[model samples]
Target: MKKMYLSVVFLLCGAVLHGQQTPSGKVFRAGAATSNITPKIGTSNNGGMQDITIRSIHDETLARGIVLDDGQTRLAIVVSDLCMISREVLDEAKRRASEVTKIPAANMMMSATHTHSGGTACPVFQSEPDKDYGKFLSARIADAVIRANHNLAPARIGWGVGSEPTQVFNRRWKMKPGTPIINPFGKEDRVKMNPGIGNPNLLEPAGPVDPGLPVVSVQTPAGRPIALLANYSLHYVGGNGPGEVSADYYGMFANRMQQMLGAEGQDPAFVTVMSNGTSGNINNIDFGGKAPDAVLPYEKMRAVANVVAAEAFKVYQNIKYQDWISLSSAQKEISLGVRKPAADELVRAKDIISKAKKPIMTSMEEVYAQETMAMKDYPDQVPLILQAFRIGDLAITAIPCEVFVEIGLDIKQRSPFKPTFSISLANGYNGYLPTPEHHKLGGYETWRAKSSYLEVDASTKITASLFELLDKLEAANH
Candidate 1:
């Protein structure tokens, strides 16, 4: 009886030891030539389109599979610098990666920075492409996956949040009493006299700004930082011109972080990746229209990018490293139906199309037109992905779409996990996921814009699904 009891003790000890083992992670910089790509005209800035070259560029975050105490699943995260990752492309990438690495398709979460100035717009959405830009991007992104798999190493992880108020501003300005503005139809209109003018009235004076800059620092057991992933929601619009193909503020921010950390020798084979949060209605420019005397320029964008990066470095210094952890990830697809164009709206669209002047427009304009037509035809069928991965105290909720700030706040408010980072524009960019109320306002985001194809209710439904997934993951963890 004594011998049997000793053997049982040994077995239990081994199980505990196995459960506490740290999972490995890897970081790799998949550099590609993305310069010479022009900004999609008519969407944002049309400043005399120049041939812009990429400076500091976008990156991919590839975390290896980590099995948590549950011992039944694994998780991976990939961050890229593109306008948005489409479902088709994401599905293909996952399928390919799984074939190569045996990492299940559902176990991985991929997101883009939503940088307007990056390579050609994704072909899945944009009907036309600038030369071979799409092909180049697809190949380069795949390379990132392969490289990350090669660089896997045993590392400790730490997470923390910090804030920088001056770097980002709420672009949606509330119209003050007596403020004058032109209507979308070119008629002069008086600014509403109500307090709701210019403000995002539904929540409060302003929506919850994720000043909580979530940072994940990976380091070797020797305490050297190897890579850092930081997430924020402010839209990337530092440099706005046709010729410039930069990573906007994201690139500059990453470079600044590297420089700051390098000074302390804390920078590990470092790559600072800026994952964009839900920023569908966010922009740096608050165009009060009259071409104000002082406009924020591209150079100002670079400066702000550096400032944001500096703020991230401040948070990085405070992270406490931990090694004993397990990892598990789950992803589910929720179906989102498209908004059909109203009967009267279809007639109006037909009239507008008949009167449109340009016979030859750029690919960007064509995409915009196509999305509008899609709204009039079949309701778009889109897949909403809710993916979650837990690494000790750090849990990442990957949501699809350009999520609004409110949604992210809502997730954080109810999340059972501490430091649960919500990443938007992940796996696929179906379009702007606006709250149900925003849909009623009938603004650009809520409308059938060229880039987005879904209705406003889609955002709310998707957010609810995400929260559900988080709740389940948290329960499983316990």
Candidate 2:
């Protein structure tokens, strides 16, 4: 009897150390909220080669977030409306939230929506971030998490993936032989980005498009919706008026989803988040088709949002909501080399800038010359945060770059979870992540600019690290 008692005691202690709470009485809970992060007029906006000042506010930008607690472990997922946010800004936001909620910073995964008209938070090309706006943005992001945590209630969660093939197309195309495709670096490019519609010289697309729309929905035990988080690989659909600040299609999708699900006017207000997926090489333009009819400002984005939200609503109805499931998150920081300019490249860049007609670049050649000079001042290496989350049988991986669709597809194929999807521009911004083969083809995405300055092998390293993290989560959950 004494020996049996000792064995039982040891087993109970081990269970406690592993954080296995008693299953019979535990409950799964969730909460979601949004915090507006829209900038005032005259604030700097990103997503263009040159800096832009916001002349108007067409729509409000937001930092939408969800918090999930599986009776033991907690996880937070946030999507912000901005072109790109640096690692420094996200880290600060995480720290602030962690202080309030007691959740480790690593357990939170945050990403940007890649909205072209949102407030600037990272310097890309010539658009510099407004330092005050960055500070305000961080606080607002943290507030989103804090408010969501405060609203936690008993909930059920489910996930499913649907397809919207008609909306996504590979934007990079291979031109016919000897096509005059000149890059900003005075070199010939085999592929052209957004090659004009109906161009006979276009041979074929250079990459593949991912049409998967993965969604995770949470609701009260009695069936009232709490939040819906959806991921799609198509880049932002931009049709906002010039100098107008908007969340692009992301915000539109959120609003459309609320209406479709009849989630409006709820006590806590339903939150819907449309996160950008792996779309560095994907877009909505149909290059092989006829010229599209020009639409008024915000019209194109609204139409696209309706299509995506309709698909999401169709998928949302069929998901099998689980009353209780496990949640786990794993994060890692990896260092990558920066693709700095070569000695000869710097000399050429200086010469090009000296001969420019004006200080403000008017041509691609001049703009890239300045980018080359700026690359000289960057550090030899930088760190990126990679994260993965497991909710029941579904898996979500987060990469800090504008990840290519091929990489996302490869991860989905190899992941231990069945319905795995990737969220791009997550945790931080690290520029465009192209495959090594794409780098060799030398398209605009692989140009030697701040927007694409990671070493050629950065994607390989990031994917490998993510697999390790996913494996860790799988083992722990099992």
Candidate 3:
């Protein structure tokens, strides 16, 4: 019949040029949200000790977000299970998600999966940040970036790198020299952190382990997978026993990666995030081969969240999706020099706080060396805030502290970008930064309390201000 109507009009014009939706060349937009932010159960569980007991939540500490807009640069990356979130709750959650997604609070990129049982989610040690749980964690991190900026669409981006490295090791060790410990700054350290695993004068692990995990996958141009951002290096696994309050192992790695990617019977929200790299010295013990009935405590947080949710579903089944690329974000503010305690170490910290008789100080390395000689001349500088993002060739770096895994593998071996990872405790809190040869190997992250008091060349000036703001966000959208 007329050559079958010209072969059905050439197969309907090749299905209208392959249904024209997304082949990815750049229009890039994405969205994601999550809220929860746990807390409530005698709060205050900043990694134990305030008499280690009252802390019972068990799971539900979130505030995840993802909102990228490449209609010419827009980025909002938040992830907070907690146990650190200060620069006043990450600049009041990027100024209330930049007052309802007007975006730009320095292109907002907050982080904190440093989950050592993240419960009373922030107001850290000596109080003053918990005015109604910091406005309910800055209104649920700006309601998860204004519900991921009202759900932007047309997405596709993927990046992957895996290596569980036998359940992340390197918790500090290195003993044998007349094996006599003391550490938590009671002094006598030759390196120690979980030093008891098969103690026989240990002699190893003084740092090294990037058992990688880098993942970044956001789909849905009809592929359906709204989010997945991962970056590991261990440093959170807690046993969930005594006083519970756990999100440890990052709430079993975003609820077993939303039941392995397909988000199962759906909607507990599908956006799994787990950033916390530079492991501040890595964790999830192996200590001389930890086994007594293998994996316990929330079953080793569901076996390390099912080996990082099966490597983010093998990096979202090897992403070949890309709708657009070329997005950028950069923010900086560096200034170190808060390493006080001189003047004969503040006269031996007021002669050990005049024999610490009470203010409840039975040792936290003598009340953080009397809180580093009572904040010697008060906050004389430590202001940090470094961020850089440029998805599509993926490189995200943001450091606030607890950093270490060899400065996140030396900024991913001098990042000129190539799946470069690094998201350590983002926004603020500069406790341990180590490395000046691990502060001459003193251990407990180079004691001097007030939480590993910075400035031992604060890791070469925050690794040269995050490689000069990652070469100015790689010479931005040009």
Most TM-score-accurate candidate: 2
How accurate locally, in lDDT, is each candidate? Answer: 0.58, 0.91, 0.75
lDDT of 2 by residue, 213-256 (tens): 99999999889999999999988889889999999999999999
In candidate 1 the C-alpha lDDT for residue 272 amounts to: 65
Residue 357 shift from truth in candidate 3, angstroms: 5.5
Candidate 1 CA-lDDT value: 0.58
Q: How close is candidate 2 to the true structure, as a TM-score?
A: 0.95
Question: Which parts of model 1 have CA positions greater than 4 angstroms off?
Answer: 1-74, 123-127, 130-132, 176-208, 263-268, 285-298, 360-371, 378-380
How do the residues 124-143 of candidate 3 rate in per-residue lDDT, one tens digit apiece? Answer: 33432346777788888889
Q: After superposition, how far is residue 434 of candidate 2 from its true place, in Å?
A: 0.3
Writing each residue's lDDT as its tens digit, candidate 1 over 259-328 gives 7877334322455678887666665543322232444546766777777777787888888877646566
> What local lDDT score does residue 145 receive in model 1, on the 0 to 100 scale?
51
Worst 10 residues of 1 by lDDT: 27-36
Among all windows of 10 consecutive residues in model 3, the one with the lowest summed lDDT is 16-25
Candidates 1 and 2, the one with greater lDDT: 2
Q: Which portions of model 2 show Cα errors greater than 4 Å? A: 1-24
